[model samples]
Target: MNYRTNPKNGDKISQLGYGCMRFPSSATAGVSDIAEVKRLIKTAFDGGVNYFDTAFVYGDSEKVLGEVLEDLGIRDKILLSTKMPQFSCKSGADFETYFKKQLAALRVDYVDYLFIHNVSEKKRWDELKSWGILDWIQEKLDKGQAKNVGFSCHGSTSEFKAILDDHDWDFIMLQYNYLDENWQVGREGLKYAADKGVPVFIMEPVRGGLLADKLPPKAKTAFDNLPTKRSYASNAIRWVLDQPEVTMVLSGMSAFEQVTDNLTTASEINAGGLTDNERSAYVAAAAAIREFMDVYCTACGYCLPCPKGVSIPDCFYYYNLSFIDDMASVKRNFAGFVGNGNISACVGCKACERHCPQSISIAEKIAAARTRFGL
Candidate 1:
């Protein structure tokens, strides 16, 4: 795999880092099977992926990753990253509380990379300060509990820039895919980070797999017409890697096939390597995506387990699909998510919105699905 230098420490991070959240779920248990996860991780690591990112809130992700890395005896050979779940921190002690828990879950005393979890706005950062955010980070740095510090962004460009300039961060992770080039801490924030010499690691490089699966007809056609014919995921990933400002991309590969696909894209597609036709195709597909997108959701599943077990992401997915695809086909697949008593489970609670990186009005969209498809 290709590598990029971490501006702060000169670490040669793999260009295609593994995001450890979406491990292939077991058909019976719904959580990732330990054996399968180990195999998938081993494949990626053997393929030259040295960076793996996990988070405390990503449902047993830290435990599963720690187990796989330890079992493989490759923990020392990789760059390990995890988050602090700051949204749950209310005081200085809470910081220590969560960090201790994360280290325990990860089965490591120190992390190569640590983050403030999801700092979307300056207001949140300000609150973190009142709770002693800076002092805690410095302690970790001085004591060797963390080697590098950064944050993941999911806010407006203004909020992103505010936090970025507020401190000398080693790096920052942002959502960058073909569909989000001009949205959410878009290219403008990316350029700002590049100018500051803060390496920008990318998340959601394929829009949570939406670019690969649910493209509108026009968007699919635009990509389908290309002579080279790569998967929608590869085309989207290549577009992000083509930008010189991107330091690396974190693909949450759930299966072995995805690991191989990403590895091929990483080794072959270099910066500024996209052909003019491919570039134009990205332009055309992006426009079509925007024109037909109903709810601006990435299906990240952060807004999940709705107090009532309402499947929030699936609701938006089918709701959006109804518009661009055949109604009969949409309804057939959507039958499991809605067209029953499921959509009615959403109790108009706004809890999902708080965690949604895309800031979708989830309850409102769920309501729309109820009215339009919950027959």
Candidate 2:
């Protein structure tokens, strides 16, 4: 497997990091199955994957990871990364409370990588400081409780730049995919971090399984003509790994089959792996997927003064879910989305569409969604 040097310590981190959020469910129906989770961990290690990522909010992931590591006696062999839930804390003292709890949950004395979970806006930055966030973190680093300090962001490029410029971070993580290269924290942010000599870790490389499935008919045809045998999921993964700046790409694999498939793909992937023809095919496929979009709102919130309590961007997101070639599980999410807001409330006002960057026919898209979903 390809490995990249951690900018701070020069440690060789695997390109494919295992995200433990997808571990098999236990009797709690959402909690991870300890035995199966351990097996998956062992399998990943055997396949040359050494970076494991988990978080406090990922459905008891820390506890499961701790149990599995202790049971298997391989905790030292793997690099453990987890996050602090700053949102759950009301005061600066609460930071230490949660940190101690997480250490016990993971049964680890120190974390190799620890991040302030999901800082997406300036408001969160204000909150972090008001609560002495940096001071508490510096204490952990000085005390050797955390090997590195980092953050995972789901904000815009401008906001991300502000964060990057504001701190002397060890590393930074962001959501990046072929589709999101120009979306949240786009290509500009990716390159900026790389230029600053910061190793970037990528999350949502598959766009939350959207690219893995729901390929447009034209896009599916592109994959079908490919000479190499691989799934749509691996294609998306390979695209991320092709970038030289990305230190590690995190994949949330849910089942044993998924875990096995991802491990195989990760070990086989290399930088500059895709040929010119294959690169063109993937780009063409992405364009075809974009054509299926009914609206171009961009979720910028420019037109938010709705007379009715309708969330336009969320409405569009759910609307897109219903148009998938095979509904399967997405249909349920679509149904729930409409139950929250109806298209009938749009009032046919041109105000929203006027400010839309993509110039999408907002009223038309909502009307279509209403009729199509039988809402």
The worst-scoring run of ten residues by lDDT in candidate 1 lies at 336-345
TM-score of 2: 0.83
> Whole-model lDDT, candidate 2?
0.80
Clashing pairs in 2: none
* Best TM-score among the predictions, by candidate number: 1
Over 32-119, each residue of candidate 2 has an lDDT whose tens digit, in order, gives 7788887888888888888999888777889989998898888888889998877678899988998899999999999999988877
Q: Which residue pairs in candidate 1 have backbone atoms (N, alpha carbon, C) closer than 3 angstroms, thus clashing?
A: none
Angstrom error at residue 181, model 1: 0.7
CA error at residue 189 for candidate 2, angstroms = 0.4
After superposing candidate 1 on the true structure, give the runs of residues whose Cα lies further than 4 Å from its correct spot. 337-339
Q: Which regions of candidate 2 deviate over 4 angstroms?
A: 294-321, 324-371
Residue 344 lDDT, candidate 1, scale 0-100: 71
Residue 129's lDDT within candidate 1 is 88
